[model samples]
Target: MFCNQCEQTAKGTGCTKVGVCGKQPDVAALQDLLIYALQGLSLVTAQARAKGVSDAAVNRFINEGVFSTLTNVDFDPARFQVLINEAVAHREAIKLRAGLTVDNPAATFTPAATLEGLVAQGEQHGISEALEAHEDLRSLKQILIYGLKGVAAYADHAAILGHEDESVYEFVQRALVKSLENLGVDELVGLCMECGQINLKAMELLDGGNTGTYGHPVPTEVPLGPKKGKAILVSGHDLKDLGLLLEQTAGKGISIYTHGEMLPCHGYPELKKHPHFHGHYGTAWQNQQKEFSEFPGAILMTTNCIQKPVESYKGNIFTTGLVGWPGVTHVGKDFSTVIEKALEMPGFAADEDKGSVLTGFARNAVLGVADKVIAAVKSGDIRHFFLVAGCDGAKPGRNYYTEFVEKVPQDCIVLTLACGKFRFFDKKLGDIGGIPRLLDIGQCNDAYSAIQIASALAGAFGCGVNDLPLSMVLSWYEQKAVAILLTLLSLGIKGIRLGPTLPAFITPTVLNVLVENFDIKPLTTPDEDLKAILG
Candidate 1:
């Protein structure tokens, strides 16, 4: 299985054996086939739309299927088999209804019952297909595909909150078909930028859904230590799951604590108001194996970034909403089993004093104090804005982000989002002109907030976003960051510093294209990069 859809792809190149994320060959093959089938579904749907017919069910399923293929989300080949068959059925249904002829191999191919047959089909439709094309064109195709994966993930989150944008779904289908065409490098590059543009709308929809449902996030202190009680540790980025668990566990002597991306949930008033909704429990998702095992409670994984469970804590693991492990219990919105397991486990013997970290500086929270921030910038109280954001990884060079944050000048302000903040979130960065020097934005999905805040700052300065005194220092580990990066490029925002490494899928020629077109580059030493930016 050759896969390089994530930051940790083996040796900064395609993973030809087991995935760096622990995905086995069979699972990788299945995911590729699933995407291939989904593309077939997209072709039929795109054709159907031309005949004034669109299937919302097919659109929702496409979003969900793409989200499941994201890193660390699902590894069960059995599950992918079911999704692939469903996509085939959906494709056929759409074609019959629209009276359109199915011309693509994906639309007419039948999956063999045996694993050998399935693997053969997947090999024909995998990234190797891109390899058969021109190098630059292949890179552009991969970029567009990865960006859509991010869009699907965010759009799924919004759909959970009863927020749906048909236009985003339509763009996804159109782009999928576009990527398969015999387009030139320039056309494919244009399509890649379009994916980024649509992602901005997708992020905005998710932001609206989250804030609309949970209320705007306010600056709140989330304890890093445990509280004394039975607890349910909720991880991943699904606020709906966390809210449901909070409601089910209320007054049951169980404390619901956030983990991973859920760390920013404390700043939302609606979630924070729960008397038993206690503090955070662990660090980023990468550290879950050690952290989850030590904690004496049930663990609910709501979405992606879930590692395969170790024996010690596997019994306590429960997954919901598209996250799955081979043997872990999968639940619906109802988390009764998770609550029961939490109650059955030994409660925290005593509370610790690990202090707290402040989060919830989403767009509204930051913009609410726009006047104060603007005054600080004008008076030179705040000299620079560094968006130290994106996914965190266990790789070596990741320490650059932590070190960079440490050495940032006292007068500068830091805006961070996603799990990357955990690297230096515990550090004591004080306030600047009444605003915290290090402002914690919401989750990775809250990249929308960062974009909004940057645009607002540019407006105040009477310049484009790139002309502001702000620079985006991002560390991407997965596809959501891909979509956000595309969104930035689509908006013509340049000078983004991305690390710990560039994607393995991007050939050097394609890398030069990104460097030339968007002015994107890899991170240098923290000191060197800082001097270059500040000088």
Candidate 2:
């Protein structure tokens, strides 16, 4: 098995033996096969769409199926076999419905009879085989595929909240088919850009779903301290799952604490209103091994970014949605098992005041103070704005983000989102005239909020976003970050600094095209980059 779809791929290259994410070769092969099956489904679905016979079930399944293959989402080979089987079932159903037949291998592909057979078949359809093309073309195809995975994740999240866009699904199917073609560098790059634009739409729908379901996030203070009571730690990026757990656990004496990317849930009015909803725990996904082991209660992984659970607390961890582990308990809507586990475990014995951090500075909250922000900018109170955001990983050199934020001029306002802010989230940056210097802009799922805030600020100042006094210093760890990068480029945003390292799949030739076209730069030292941006 060879996989390099994430920032932490083994040795900065493909993971050949086992995934650095703890995915075994069998699981990796199954994931590859699942994706191969989905491509076939997409081939048929694209034709069905052309015949005006689109199915919502097909669209939703494709989105969820594609999302499951993303790094660190599902590590269960059995689950992937089930998904592969379902993909073929869906493909066949759609083919019969549309009364059309296609000769493409992907369109006519069939799943193996058993799990072992599926894994064997999957090995034949791995990433290396899929991209048996020119190096530059393969690089562009990898970018497109990763970006599509991100789009699917966001689309699945939005669809869960009843926010469905037919065009987004249409684009997903079309792009899946496009990846199969022998497109030139220019055309493949164009598809990558198009994937970015589609991701923007998916994020928009997600923004609507999140803000629509939970009232727009308002600025709120969340504790990093411990509370005395039964506890359940909710991780990953699913607000709906978090909300349901919060509702079910209410009055059961269970205190639900946010973990990892779930830290921003405290800002949502509906979620926060739950009296038992407690504070945040841990930092980011990569630190979960130490963090999860130390947690005093049960853990529920709602979506992606799940690392291998340690033996000590592996039994205490439960997974929901598409996230799965071979031995961890998989949960459904009813979280009684999670609640029971929390009840059986020892929760915080005593309350402790461990200070707090501000969150929920999403678009609504930030833009509501547009006047003050504009005044601060005009009065020279706010010299510049730095959007230091993206996923946080366990790799070395990530300290660059910590140092970058630490060295950001006091006069500049720092807008951050996602787990990357964990580096300096607790810093005492204070506020300029009343606006906080460091603004927490929700989760990576809420990137649309950051884009909206920047667009609004630019609108108020009568200039393009690049013309604003803002610089983006981003750190990417997975496919979601890839999609976000594409969105920024698709919007014609420039001069963005990205690190800790460039993606292993991005050949130098492809990197040159990005540098030449979008002015994208690899990050240097914080001091050097700060000076470059400020000057």
Candidate 3:
């Protein structure tokens, strides 16, 4: 088995024997097969669009298909197998109406896969195609593929909120089709940029859906303690799901605490108003294996960055919306399974004081104070704005982000979102004109919020996002980070710095394309990078 679709790919090259993420060879092949099947489904979905089919069901297929392939999102073979079957079924259903034959895609595991059954094989070898492809070609293809995964994850969250963007689905399918072939670098690169373009629209739709549904998020302090009695820790990047859980558990004695990417949920006005919503627990996604072990409550993963579970207290963990683990409880659309599991956990201490941590300041909430922000800028009270955002992962150099945040000039404002902020989210960066520099925007999906705030600031300054004395020093660990990077490039944002490391899958040629078009550079150090960015 060979896999290198994440920050921890073995040796900074590829994971050849087994995934360092604990994904075995068979699991890797199954994931590839799942992507293969999704491409077929995407072909059908794309064709259906040509024939003018407009239904949430088709869009749902695209959303889920792309979503299921994101890095560290889903690891259940049963669930992966189910999605493959569902894709085949959906492809046929759409093709029957379109009068198409709907043959299986060129790159799939056949029923001959029957003998292998994935579980029994446990350690499958990588396909020669994936294992032996030219590194640049593979890298570019992976970029496109991974970017779509991010798009799908974001689309799924919005679909739950009843906000479905058909354009996003259509693009996801089309991009998947491109990845399923020997498409030349030029064509693949075009599709990669298009992924960026469409992602912008997709993000805008999600932004509208979130603010429209939850009202604009406002800055609020989130408690950082385990409330006395029953509590559940909600992780990953789905605000709508967290909101629903908050509503359902409001007075039922089940307290909700945000974990990882969900840490920013505390700032949303609608969600913060809930009496039972406690506070953030733990720092970032990477620390979960240790942090979760000590927590007494159940954990619910709504999306990505989930490592394989540990033996102790494994059953207390539950997942939904494309996040799956082999032994963890799988919650359906209703979340009853998660709620039920939370009730069964060892639970909390009697009379325990709830902890508090501050959050919110998402795009809308921050923009609501645009006038004040503008005034602060004019007064030179806020000399610089740093958009330090992206995903989190288990990597050594990631400490750079924490160090960088700690080293930021006091007059600057650090606006962050996604799990990466955990590097410094708890640092208490103080304030400039009564506003804390360490402002947490919602989830990774709320990368859109950071974009919105950046764009608004640019407009206020009569400049483009890149020209606003703002630097986007980002760290990417997964596919969702891919989507956000594409969105930034799509907007022609320039001179942004990205690091801990470059994706092993990214070829020098594709990297050049990104550099030539977007002027993105790798991160060096706080002193060096800050000087380059701020000077």
The 10-residue segment of model 1 with minimum total lDDT is 129-138
- Pairs clashing in candidate 1? none
In order, what lDDT does every prediction score? 0.89, 0.92, 0.77
lDDT (tens digit, per residue) of candidate 1 on 1-535: 8898999888888899998888988888888888888888899998899889988888999999998999999987778878888888898888889998988887787887877678777777778763336766777788889999999999999999988999999999888777667788878888888888888999889998999999999999888888898988999999988888888888899998889999999998999999999898889988999999998999999989999899999999999989988888889988889989998999799998899999989988899999999999899999999999999988789999999999999999999999999899888899997799999998998988998998888898899998899988999999999999999999998889999999987889989978998899899999999998999
Index of the highest-lDDT prediction: 2
Question: lDDT at 311 for candidate 1?
Answer: 97
After superposition on all CA atoms, what RMSD does each candidate show versus the true structure?
1.1, 0.8, 2.6
Query: Per-residue error at 461 for model 2, in Å?
Result: 1.2
lDDT of 3 by residue, 33-93 (tens): 7666777777777777788865568678767866776777877777776676777777777
The candidate scoring highest on TM-score is: 2
Residue pairs in steric clash, candidate 3? 222-357, 223-279, 223-355, 223-356, 224-355, 224-356, 225-355, 267-360
Residue runs of model 1 more than 4 Å from their true location after superposition? none
Worst 10 residues of 2 by lDDT: 126-135
Ranking by lDDT: 2, 1, 3
lDDT of candidate 2 at residue 6, scale 0 to 100: 95
Per-residue alpha-carbon lDDT of candidate 2 for residues 225-269, written as tens digits (9 for 90 to 100): 989988999999999999999989878998999988999999999
The whole-model C-alpha lDDT of candidate 3 against the native structure comes to 0.77
